[model samples]
Target: MYKSTLALAVAVGVLAQQANAAGFVEDSKLSLSSRTMYFDNDNRDVKRDARGRNGDNRESGQGFKLDYISGFTEGVVGFGIDAQALWGIHLDGGKGHHPDNSSFIPSDTDGSAVSQWGRFGANAKARFSKTEAHFGSALAPNLPILVSNDGRLLPQTFEGGTIQSKEIDSLTLNAGQFTHAMGRASSNRTGLSVAGGTQDSNKFQFAGGDWKVSKDLTLQYYYSNLEDFYKQHFLGLVHVLPIADDQSFKTDLRYFDSSSDGKNGEAGYQFSNNGGYAKNTGEIDNKTWSAMFTYTLGGHAFLLGHQQIGDDGGFVWLNQGSVVDDNGRNEGAGGASFYLFTDSMINQFARAGENTTFGQYSYDFARLGVPGLKTSISYLRGDDIRNKSGDGSYNEWERDARIDYVIQEGTFKGLGTSLRHGVYRGSGEAGADMDQTRLIFNYTYSFM
Candidate 1:
């Protein structure tokens, strides 16, 4: 015990010295969250066989997270570390309350909750000039060909290394290779790949760049390839058009094209035929695009957005799915916050048929009275899901809402809380219609 205490003290002293010299230090924060998820199928009477293995279900759960970010070293090349610890407990729901298809929470063979589970990981990073690189066991990632799945109770994490650079003007470059993954509700690390793909080749590679042409215009390009899986490319543009003295409209455009590669590449897959699982051999071509605009007036912001997917195949890939939370910036989170366009449903252009559309509206309560508070509501509907053999088409729709708050001042300054709700319905497909809600509360205490 004395040795442990001494070690901790020495570690703290080193962190303090580093923080003072390099503007970085070892810091910690914690958050608590709760979620009440419900799954119901409106078309249950249509076909009992379509209910999947889990049938229809509803359940409630609670989660916790502890995070630490270390300060960089005082030198020409600074070094630092990031660590996260997480756990979740089942508050409600049992075997009968959960869909057999959803593994949001693990269970015993007898259909009872496994009680609880926990996970921990750390990443080491080095920075020089405008570039930084980190490698370790953490969030698997979210890219074009290997996007992680967060539709369950937790976000997934991966083991890998990533590098980013922005030394030249407005151009930013990113590259990485991931080797393994851990699900949001799991602690053990496993080989990386799609949900039903082979685990033999554990490496997934990606690289990309983003360039800013003007103050209001930007361009982006990225490429990702999953070994024995698929390859994807993304192109995007963002422009802010000045409308009037205090009004401007922002437009976000994105496109993705993907196909099988290597052993899983177009010709390779087709040649082997059943060599790949899920009858997913051969190649797939697909694209997804979105455009949005936001106008602000007297603290009131109105936003409208639309997205479409060209039905060529299922959605593209990024990385294997996991439960570790991530943002547009690729930083990990344990609570309920997520990046834009990463909906629980309609992800990866999975909606069947041929086309999809979604719209959203948001407001800042600060204009009304509460400063540090915001809310948003959105709706999405997708159709034309082309089933194999071209027999029929499937459709889906979702209604989602979010509310968040942060402390403005006082001793509790910087504390934050959030709530998210989503209602999803699907028909003419093998998927289910369901409702889900997430509640998260977070507090960060910085020891400067």
Candidate 2:
């Protein structure tokens, strides 16, 4: 954090010297985004916590994000800066409704939701030729190996330095090193670690590239490692075949290979194997693959996919759920995202030896003369999940549906609203059965 801050300060100083340069202030933009959300989760197989309260969560909150982006200064090597401010306000839900390990909202010392919380972050960037470098605390990477989460009031951010080069005609290269992460709902930053691991690892390095082989085909490969934790490699391929003027078929394939690193199974650095069977408890070892096919015709689209997890263990991703503060309180780093089709609203059907099949259908209302409306429904089912006893397996399923609309014109133009709901049911080592719903409203105002 200190190094990133110092680097940012130096970049700011350099930019200040050229504040009046031609492109510096002329191409700047500012925007303010607002979101209001209501969340409800009903635990069907309710289990009481230490406070004797059922494991149900209901809450409402408002979030605001302010951003400023300045274009690079004119020169052989251009410099720029980006800044962000986020604030979250809790509007409803009492202690009984807020879980001790709530990931959607930050908690107070007394175990209730915090009234309000906020954070500020900035990035300094430089560009030369077709390459760019950014150093900051607001870095959000959406690569094959690492994905920044944004399912809550604010977005999860990382303190890191990243470089991207597009010098090649049809290829892009990316590399980065992240040291810490700021949770979506918390104001503090913490080191990175995997699920069920109480200790933190400060270094996470990744390098990858994407090559557009042709107009309709692309391939990707990436490698990442977290010190004393795990190492992962990813390969992906995407191709789109045009069937007609308004019809197309898309195929997406992804695979991951992962294994343990130094101290991966040691105390405070263990991996939970995602609560499923593990070849060696607390060790990381897995291979997973998925293929998705989509067919689109006019305003209608259909998607189907299948995924399989290796029997050795569940898939692994960067997670900080077990990292707590000195007082043993969760530091709001519980939520994470993986680049997978099973990253559903209610549950991730990713476990050892699990085989999942899923499908979805969506429609755009524009074809029906309602330009700004859309809806989709999806279902996923996974079976043959290995159990710890190593003698049996289990199964689980989830159904998710969502609707969205935006005011296309008028005073509320660009205002969007979305309603999403999910139902999950499982047995054996699967997660608890639950129904969850979220209603959100969003709007953004831009200033140039």
Q: For residues 391-445, could you state the per-residue lDDT of candidate 1 as single tens digits?
A: 3366667788889999999987877777777777767553555566556665655
| Model 2: CA > 4 A from native | none
lDDT of 2 by residue, 1-448 (tens): 5667787899899999998998989999999999999989888888787887686789999999999999999999999999999999999985598886788888788888898999999999999999999999988899988889988888999998999999999999999899999999899988899988888898999999999999999999999999999999999999999999999999999999999999999999988888898999899999999999999999999999999999999899997748666667776778899999999998888789999999999999999999999999999999998887663469999999999999999999999999999999999668789999999999999988
Candidate 1 to native Cα RMSD, angstroms: 7.2
**Cα RMSD to the true fold for all candidates:** 7.2, 1.1
Q: For candidate 1, what is the TM-score?
A: 0.77
How many clashing pairs per prediction, in order?
31, 0
**Top model by lDDT, which number?**
2
True-structure lDDT of candidate 1: 0.59
